[model samples]
Target chain A: MNDHELDIILKKSLQPDVSVDDTLFNEKEELKNMKPMWIIKPAIALVACAAIVFSVFTFNNNANVTTNNSSQSTDTTNAFALKVKAVGKQVIELKKDVSIASRYGEVGAWGGGENDDNNYETDYYETFPIACEGNNIDKITYSINNGSFQIINVKGDGFVVDGEKVAPLDKGGILPKSCSDRGITNMEDMLAENYEEGYYSSFTVDPDFQESEDVIVNICDNLTVDEETYRKIWCFSVGPYKDKDISKLSKEENIKMLELVKEGMNDVLSNVVINCTVTYRDGTTESKEIGVTKIVVTPEEAKTLEGFKNKKVKVPSLYTAYKAL
Target chain B: MNKVEFEDMIKQYGVDLLRFCRMYLYSKEDGDDLYQDMLLTLWKKRDKIDYDANVKSYALSVAIRIAKNRRRTWSIRSRIAPESSYEQMLDSGTQIKLQDSKAKQSSDPEDIYVNQEQIIMVRNAANELPNKYRAVIYLYYSADLSIKEIASCLKLPENTVKTRLSRGRALLKERLEAMYYE
Candidate 1:
């Protein structure tokens, strides 16, 4: 349909019939009868204070235990402790060995245990480390393989890990049947639960390759880091895709295709340039270009990487995936 | 603004504001609640608002801000609790009410059926849009707001509003066509 027809339909569909007069009258009456805020404020404040104190105590205890346990693990240290140095007043240099892994892996059968041989498909993703310090990141603009930087808009109140803001990226995944049965359909809830269950170790954001610019991904916008701890932003999947006629390809050909896809993704990751606009505590803003080291790895090699073993790292963008094709 | 002036303003723009809330929230009950909240907020801040300015635009901006804040709170709450019986009830009830209202719009049974189906399809398409586009589209169409008014309310560039409006229309049309063919 044309724009005018669509506009008419939109107007009809959106403008629902309702008794506005009654609604306004009722609302006005409610407003007139509403209790003064002073009476409720103190009660709410007391309850809020109690809740905050209890939560903080419990959280600190849990955090202490977590810190102790994590400190003992080399893998955790390597994965969580991103290395960076101040290049100048505004720039921070990422170490050359800091790299991202792009992997192509099999998710499962298409229809969940239907077990048809033709249904097996592979997915691709790239996992990288991002760090911010001394300021809140408003947004990150990243260029893949020297392409134009695409802006990822971040939002949310992220958790602090070791004085650094650790925000989860939107690594899109299907809600498990068990969770769905429990009426847990929110992706954030699922991600939080998964993180708690040790299924996810770092923050993830879903990669959008459809648009050339302005790919918005929600994370913690208010995350600020101190001098010491640099938060490691985790893996984001490009989103899942079913292979086209995987049944027709020979086993060797399938393996080759996966390798090719992996290579294409790594190529994008290798030549990445990320710039972040940060809002400092003093209200000053600066856009700093982050330097990254590119270490390309195969799926097998990725498995041997510290803190990455036995974990399912989802792949990133259709752009690289289709490029490989 | 005085009480009489406020009431007059509400009478003039109340339906559109309520419609905007419902479209934004995609729930009749929540929309009503939001509308009430907006009214109460507007009433409380009446002394601070300038009477001669674009009062409608100011009122809408308040509604948008409140709606956004409410949506954010809902997201956080949903993450914590995962589900709420009240929300489910509201959603299902709203769907039924929408269908019933559409059916009552025409006397002819066949026409009513077709109209209801078309309305449902369009609503679904609109609902599926991302918040940015949906807000722009709803403000432009449902609230009868001009592009300049929408930009002011949304705090977006006029060109950005135009782009989102165009994109929202394109997406809506695509979805409607797909539903029709299906």
Candidate 2:
């Protein structure tokens, strides 16, 4: 087609039906729904804090009773507090010397027209570090929304020893084959995997991979855990894993696994609770339950969250952002 | 601007703004959502708007900003959780129906078919362009905005807008020709 012919075609195709009435745009409804963000933020923060405090107190009380019944020698001290810095940008920090942060890297893209450079858009999937104060930690188990607790174990090679402190293999650690095999580098692949499996592999590390008792308790007495150094050592994997092997499961069992995967993926960071079991050199064991309440985010991430809350940014699915992360 | 003036502005330029949104987003549903959001935002910021200035230009600029922000968010979202095949088929069906309705002026079946094919080709070609080029092309042709107006809305120089339009047209021509041959 000539330039003039192309212009005519372009105009015709690009111009939408302007005569159609907008039934969706109701000013009165929109105005009525628009509450000031300043009012909503404080109310939400207060409610969240109250809920966290109540839940933590109840959990700690139950743990104390259990410890008292089981063994009179056990220490039931609340030593840890799990605070979520941000939801979309998942950052879990311990008061002592451990921090776990999930980051989505734009590895690559696929599927674009020959002439379309803009079509190459990055697909995001989460890779996070698994670090903890290994000296006192006997075992750590995490649960989502008061669900059954699942053990958090080291994956890929083994723990990294920094003088007396030990942390799980950081960012360079190998991820589960299931995650790597799917090649989740683009939108098309991600969607295909989501449809077929009903959910992406929620955890970066193999949850079923159990570490030996020796590895779990390998720590030195003189070494102090550096929270800053551990925080910087980002890992490729960390999250709750399924109890059973997927390959060995029956069809019904497979379905249940899918359900669990979907549930874990959907659960927000706010709902996550971590239970840390500490072991002292004197052979005394202590149980501590950490509850997440306050969300501390950087200024940039805060802006994005605010924009999302204000409805300025449209997220297609409720937990799709989690999938991207 | 008061509510009356806001209502008037919507009455005058709402359709164009909605059309701009649809073109930018490439989805009727999302376009409608953006349009409502734009209207709400405009109403919220009505007092701050210069009453004597080009209200349509201001409205279009707001829509553009919203579209850009939403797309940045949606880009990640769409990649992870794209619409299902059934939903996509439904969207395609809607597009065909829209094309058919628009082509009602043509009596001949062959002419309607040709028109529909041509329209889909042109749209697909345009959609493939980068946002910078597509925005300029859509504003110039779809929204009927001048280069000066587009420059003002985008906060880019008039020369930059002109360059984008020219490059956008060239890319569209190349893609359309390839599609025609295929």
Candidate 3:
């Protein structure tokens, strides 16, 4: 048949019949039958059990609880002090070892130079890279405190802290400034080159943070992707630690710790402000669901917030971030 | 209208929709899935869609957009499917090994055998055409749009569509004649 005649017949043969109703449209009303709170009960119970065990083994045994009389709050607040003490802090090994000193407490401190305040001043670095992917840092962090950070050195593959041109870390993995002179080489250089005007973004988790244990949160001076004012990004993460049973976390709480870790890391590594979203794995999505959107704050802005400055507000560590998970 | 009315519209044009879907997709499941997704899009944007003249064409337009997306999605996996070649698939890729005695007993040449042989022939002929011309032909013949319609759909001048159509027809004619001749 010629095309038109054939098309007519095809149309006639294929016309849809409307008499039938959908059989596969079965709604799972059984879900409606359940009490709305039923889903959260098991989660609450599991959290209660874990709280008891954790407090006993990780806390009660090591209790040297102190009632600090800070005007911030009147409640007995040293609940995690013993656990923090038991966690056992480690010192970083650098030429002049530096310790992180943020005015805020409970900011998880993962990696940094020792005696950073004496050697480093209050200038935030811009577009720095921790190379946490190759470094295999699962959530490196820093504490937030009162006043502006006088950042001298960044924890990149190398340091340009205070313009002294410090040497870089990895023998092979990280690209140095010399390589930056060579046509734009890595993710860090690309971010630095593209940082733009004074922009603030809600801290967002790097979309690809799932496959590797590294989370890099770039704190931008501008909210949009402007390279000119864009200063620093923090890098931290918990996984591809693949073994930390993430199934226990509420998707929202899980993303929060990642945000803090990322935010804290960026704060120490660079000098600029960044807003990020805690990006995490969605059960079925190839894309991550951003959890507790992390907002990067300048020390000045953070200090202005009530109940925030100087006091160690664990500000939700992995425990509080995923405590209910 | 509402979802029920929208569904009714889909049901009204359903047959031509299935035919168009089937012509593009080999699997019935994929065709049905595309249909449902198209229906959903139509339902969601029911007020905005101009379904005046030909609901079938309007729905087909929606189907085409969704089908292309599905094709892009599936190509990631189906790129390596064994059906890539008519030669391999037509031959069954699974030839029964004949015993020595059976090989000697077979009188007919293996090349003479056929089942739905025209499908292999048509596919091979189509595969032989260049992509640009093949696109016009596939849209006109399988998608069942008219030449003028195909030109508008492709955003090409009608003359260019006619030229490509002629070029495609010549290629298929040449291949078919040569194949049937010897």
Candidate 4:
């Protein structure tokens, strides 16, 4: 059918079934009881950092020692110094953990969503303590811009970054398939293009580059496809457009253009990968250069596109955008 | 927030939250657990939430984060019993109920049959979508949230949300045509 009919069917099918029982909120009884105490907990975690650290470490280690037991002594005079040392060590460890967590959190959780994979930060920290076990930490510092992290784990080379032993950047095999697939272009080829002119930029792991090893992924600059090419396909597929310069268009005009693009592109945009090269660790690469004419649109989408073209929408062919690009 | 206010807030947003959980998580059982956990989180942070802030949006944001974290932990569970398709995720009883609901709305026998089948087909297709696309579609269509509201809730650009909705609808349209024509 037409767009209107399609919209009707979708809206009708997706309507919420509001038959939920009122008693659903009754289960909130237990939650309500814990409210005030739970509300104050993050503040507590921030203030009583040492205690929280102690409890967390103790719980994870399954250690039987309490804060009292760790410092209790028959010599009252020495107990004060021993307690001070223990607190100092605990503070050091807490700083190290938090530093590691924050550094990796920025890397791993940066621009990530619920559907996105591999919290690099959480994964790094999960195995951090165990990996660096039996080492005494004197300092833990990291650079924000560069992923270079330094953790003083005395056993030596607990993990290595750039051939030096460090904690944060040493965890291995955290690459996503999108970044790891072979037959793509070489790292340099991916980085050769000026991306500011393009619609989007992507970051992926480049194992072949020996600069950073184990946990880090490299950004490929040349691998980016210009947004105009995709936007053209998207715009044409949504409806029709003139060869008007995108730069000359007003903000409202651009929005209208995007709205049409949305209508035409439908959901097939994710699958619309152009021929690109992927570099392997061995320095060899392959190209998956499927043309835009071969863009994977379903029969229904194709039919709908044709219908729009036949009508006043005057949608252009998907290949027209590809050919122009 | 007072107990009465909390209850009122829940009453207002519970259906939307439950529906979101169901759509996001393939299993009803997992959805139920996530729904409870989300409410617990909102309750804990109730005092911190401003009175003028949009509670529904805030609750949705919390629910999404909780679900994402839980999914990460339960990744193995998903792998072990992969509900790859919505048809597989839906129980026979639920399917029957959906069919009956459609049937009650239509007097013509053929229309009833077609409508039921179409519903099942659409639901399965919707389930197959990538999480991002499915989420946008559910919020827009089922929850009746605007594109702006959805973008705000998911912390995405409005254009991104619009693109996803377009892509999601394309998939749904593809499936509907396949079932109807072929």
Model number with the top TM-score: 2
TM-score of chain A of 3: 0.17
Tell me which of candidates 3 and 4 scores higher on lDDT: 4
Better of 3 and 4 by TM-score: 4
Sort the predicted structures by TM-score, highest score first: 2, 4, 1, 3
Give the per-residue lDDT digits (tens) of candidate 3, residues A147-251. 121121123422111121122211111222333344533333433553211111221112213111121221212112112111111111112312344347664
Number of the top-ranking candidate, with DockQ as the measure: 2
Instruction: Rate residue B172 of model 1 by lDDT.
Output: 88
DockQ ranking from best candidate downward: 2, 1, 4, 3
Interface RMSD of 4: 9.1
DockQ of 1: 0.16
Off by over 4 Å in 4: A15-19, A26-114, A117-325, B82-117, B179-182
Going through the candidates in order, their DockQ values are: 0.16, 0.19, 0.05, 0.10
Give TM-score values for chain A, per-prediction: 0.27, 0.24, 0.17, 0.19
Model 3's lDDT to the true fold? 0.34
Question: In candidate 2, what are the lDDT values of residues A1-325, reduced to their tens digit?
Answer: 6677667667767776654476236778875554221100011111112111111000000101011111222444424332322233333343432222212111101110111233322111222222323233333333223322211223333322111212321101112223233443222232245311111111111122222221121100111112222111110001121223324555444334333322323232334343444444445655454432222223344345521332221211111121111
Local lDDT at A291 for model 1: 37
Candidate 2 C-alpha lDDT tens digits along B22-134: 76766666667677878888887988988678887778888887665445334323333233421332343322334464564555443332355666677778876887899
Docking category for candidate 2?
Answer: incorrect
TM-score of 2: 0.45
Give Cα-based local distance difference scores for all models. Answer: 0.43, 0.43, 0.34, 0.39
For model 3 the local lDDT of residue B125 reads 68
Q: Model 2, residue B175: what's the lDDT? A: 93
Q: What DockQ was computed for model 4? A: 0.10
